[model samples]
Target chain A: MARTILTALVSAAVMGVGSYAASAATLDDVKAKGFVQCGVNTGLAGFAAPNASGDWSGFDVDYCKAIAAAVFGDATKVKYTPLSAKERFPALQSGEVDVLARNTTWSINRDTALGFNFRPVNYYDGQGFMVRKELDVKSALELSGAAVCVQTGTTTELNLADYFKANNLQYNPVVFEKLEEVNAAYDAGRCDVYTTDQSGLYSLRLTLSKPDDHIVLPEIISKEPLAPAVRQGDDQWFDIVSWVHYALVQAEEFGVTQANVEEMKKSANPDVQRFLGVEADSKIGTDLGLTNEWAVNIVKAVGNYGEVFDRNIGAGSPLKIERGLNALWNKGGLQYAPPVR
Target chain B: MAIGVTNVPERSKSSGSIINDPQVRGIFYQAITIIILAALIYWIVDNTVDNLRRANIASGYDFLRSRAGFDVGQSLISFTSDSTYGRALLVGFINTLLVAITGIITATIIGFLVGIGRLSHNWIIAKLSLAYVEVFRNIPPLLVIFFWYSGVLSILPQARDALALPFDIFLSNRGVAFPRPVAGEGAEYTLLAFIIAIAASVFFTRYARQRQLATGERLPVLWTVLGLIIGLPLITFLVTGAPIGFDVPVAGKFNLTGGSVVGPEFMSLFLALSFYTAAFIAEIVRAGIRGVSKGQTEAAHALGIRPSLTTRLVVVPQAMRIIIPPLTSQYLNLTKNSSLAVAIGYADLVAVGGTILNQTGQSIEVVSIWLIVYLSLSLATSLFMNWYNARMALVER
Candidate 1:
């Protein structure tokens, strides 16, 4: 009965939206709706958590805000849908959300089979492990015969299993469907160790009952390039999301902070002028289906990538994580963008 | 026909107007309804398939052969992350059946006791049973699961400070760890002895019933059956050099090692489901018992039967006729509710299916599999119960 009802509802939705989708672009849909529907993490402290006033403010949240600001010239014009790890992809594929900025990993399987387009790695991360202080375990190699807690439906689960099997070590897995459940289970001594992305481990560790009692290990097992994803087959929409991240990184590379962005519009440098959309007859933003002030709106709304990181999970926030690999290319990092001719 | 009946006129074969004929109208309306229904189904399926194709999303069960890449918390069969998704789902199905079958047995036993207690002449017992039913039946099962998981089990001592029990068992927030029985050489003989003991007990039971009918003397069947089962197994074990040994858990640097552990996730899900379903079953039992007419009990008492024997041999046997049907529904309900194991990470069918769906992006196929599997399970339960109900049904001359 449930299957029949679900199929009916899905088919009805498809029939209603399919013809419109084939004719109209995602931008037009957003324009008609007057708000960019963004999917985000349910809660991850400095990543995408809601404050006491029920307002979302975090690293992933700012990306969606920047998208809304670029499209509508108003950051607050974006609505948020908090999704679990398992619900993120389908929600985007079904047109329930415009873009998924939920710290999702960029993988070939997701990009192709799941019908999502991902580019511009937002955060450079690696899978790591966290163990209790008293466990006296030093490295991931020494975690043999230990019970490890991890969340389901994420790359971390597979990474943990692969890493253990590669090293010929045996470990029991205690998996949960949600992040908070994994946290609670680990905190309750259900598992000796917790495993996830290193950055996630840091943010989630802060939410534990005693943050001082646990320590993240120093082994980087898998490269986890977390990025925002949009539904496949819409090259224009994909380009818009991809370049939004590049614009943030480019703005930071050009030393354009949120406060100095407006002033930088009057700079004599042709590159900076064109990037800020102030150069005469510049069509960079128009070609991407937006106004000349698209970059300006993004900068004004969420600032550059550096500022976003600092304010949310970096030194300006509680996480205090260093800009190890998320820095610009000139500063010894992987964040490099195309020239804004 | 009129000539034969001698009083009534014969009816015509058909109405003058075909539109006015009731049979023709009924068939026409039915045909129209069928056409509309078929058209609607076709439209929905067509649109859904077109949408999936346009979106470039893969929609098939080919991903079942792919590596699952994630480990389950508990599995009855041997499973690893290297196993295929199909094997993982099978493991999940087995886990679900394990919980459901155990929960049904435990709930039935508890339900019978509480149901009988509700009707006890003692005031305290009746009220306590009433309170149990009222409290559990009113609250949702999910909250009960959390209450056991987060509220009760999480507060237990950690692994390093685990509470040790007798027989090398240890209890902690993680789980209860006990000795794993390792069956060595000649262990099959003990299993063979157990099977022989069971067969002998069944034969003895028939013989005892026949002897009672023939000679008017009762045999001690229960004790004899118990002795046969236990003594046979013990004698075989000793004769076979006691080829079973325990790998007792020893406290290690982090946790107890060398033994099998039952995780708290399974424990809490099982406990919560059993308790929650037992309340409804208790009500069913009470209704079934009360449904038996009072004169039946009086009639048994008027005979030479004692009070206890009257309730057991007379009242309970008849009450079972009423009990078995609803009892089947409760069993089905418990089986379905085992899907709630996912909420607590018990690795039941729904939880495992959700993981596989996310990994492979086969939402429609996965949901269809779930629908088919659950329908089969429910149908199987109903069939077995119907067969049992037929046997217990009251026979009339």
Candidate 2:
């Protein structure tokens, strides 16, 4: 009986040596550090890249700015952590970044298995192919036996295979890890096609030696729901990040632009009142441990969801991608948000 | 001499004094070390298991069998997107082996020639070798790969305007395309004959060695072996009607079609590794040769031997004793340096494992595989070098 008790105690001691306590809340860490550590892509034009003045601005950058606005009431309080696709997840897991807003795709393996919580997707995207205009290829189906260039270790690579296999088309893929290398390969005429997200195709084509020489194929191969993600464990911070996305969409649904938000706060509409935090009885901001004026800050910093879309990647930017499927629910698109009240 | 007497009795050892004894203390120290190591290993395994379970990632070798769904730029074996991740890694290993072996052969030849050139009487030849070594040896290998990949190969013309070379060869930015030989019926017989010729050459070499020991006269075994090997293979090919054909590359509207091409990725990696490693090897060769005392060559000349014969017969054997150890290190460095294939997309083991790591979210398993494979390759190389060194060291006696 005594030996059995001693063995149990020793085993318990060994168990304590292996498992560790979870990390502190990301919100608390961010607050204590006075800046949000945001993980972003090394450089993808429409998603995340530095400008001439070395300031980061893009769809993903604006989202991180929105997050910062929600927390600190200041959008410029974010310090970006540029990471490659291969190092992104490990960097998050190692606590080198507070939030990952790198236009990362949400998938089952990344969410449940990789110890992450993906907020709602900010962009609805799909895989497509870009080929030289001289090839006279109009559709992806005409790409049989074509040599395709793709980035390795991406959902785009897998989707390319599935699309080809499903269509019973043959292709030879030239894969590279870096976007620059893939672009160079395609530019050097080593491959006939380059496959990636449609928005990416637009952005990448601009960087090509001859942007006018290529055309994107008219095929949307697979769904790529690009979302922001945070590490698991710390449900409150997850709720804050998740609700920040919903608040932006809800503000857009309520027709709350940055310029009109303050004026809209004086209107008699109760839904808009609660959304803008003009109604003092509203608990949405308090529930997330923020001021009732949080949504106003987000809108002022990066505007509502539609405004963000139109400016960064939609009609205003060089990419000029249309907001077809990314429009609000009432306008025949899929973006729907819950009521702030 | 006077005998001395002691009044005190000799001290006897007690159980408490066992720590003072070297043998007993040695055992105690080793026991402590073993226990500590075992504990550390157990702790690490437990931590990894706990982390993996918490993350809900399935841990096992089962992921290797899943669909890779990715493409490699170059593969030695047949592969497609539908191939398994295990097959992808195998392709990567084959590519690495191809580069390492090919680089070693080319580097050795260039290194020996440059080393000999540096020792030449001509001032121009010696200075040129010195310049070659200094230029390559001081620069990073990664930049060298980029220099060849981007600066040289990427600047070549497009496939539609490929620079045509002799014998159905085409050079472009894509690659160098040459006719691929397709074997026909009865090709197996020729391969069998070639194998037989190699076996015969080995036996002939052993026989010549025995004859030399017995009669103190050496046979012309090098020429005999070369003739048997080449002549036997040639005779078989002719007898079999030389049933082979080439699928020559043809210039097309946009591509040079119907032939195999060596991609620029492979060419850049191969060239960079060979040139970079050859520089260090040349220095080692030069030092090894210079380490041999001048007295040995002079002794050979006093025996009325020609200068060329003295350098080959007397100086070379002694220089090899100093060269083998450092030469093994350079060979190993070249093998490890081949992992830089990722920088230019040649898809070596490290690069392939990196892709799998991201795809499967299996960082631990993939990294462990890389560590084990590189360790095994290094050990196997060192083992072979040790065997060769032992054989050479026997000559000293």
Per-residue lDDT over B78-145 for candidate 2, one digit per residue giving the tens place of the 0 to 100 score: 98878999999999999999999899899988998898788988999999999999999999999999
Which parts of model 2 are misplaced by more than 4 Å? A1-24, B1-39, B251-254, B394-396
The candidate scoring highest on TM-score is 1
Worst 10 residues of 2 chain A by lDDT: A1-10
* Model 1 agreement with the true structure over B86-191: per-residue lDDT tens digits: 9999999999999999999999999999999999999999999999999999989989999999865557898879899999999988789999999999999999
C-alpha RMSD in Å of predicted model 2 compared with the true structure: 6.4
- Best-fitting candidate, measured by lDDT? 1
Worst 10 residues of 2 chain B by lDDT: B1-10
- Interface RMSD of candidate 1? 2.7
Q: What global local distance difference test value does model 2 have?
A: 0.83
Q: Residue A278 of model 1: what lDDT?
A: 93
User: DockQ for each candidate?
Assistant: 0.56, 0.32
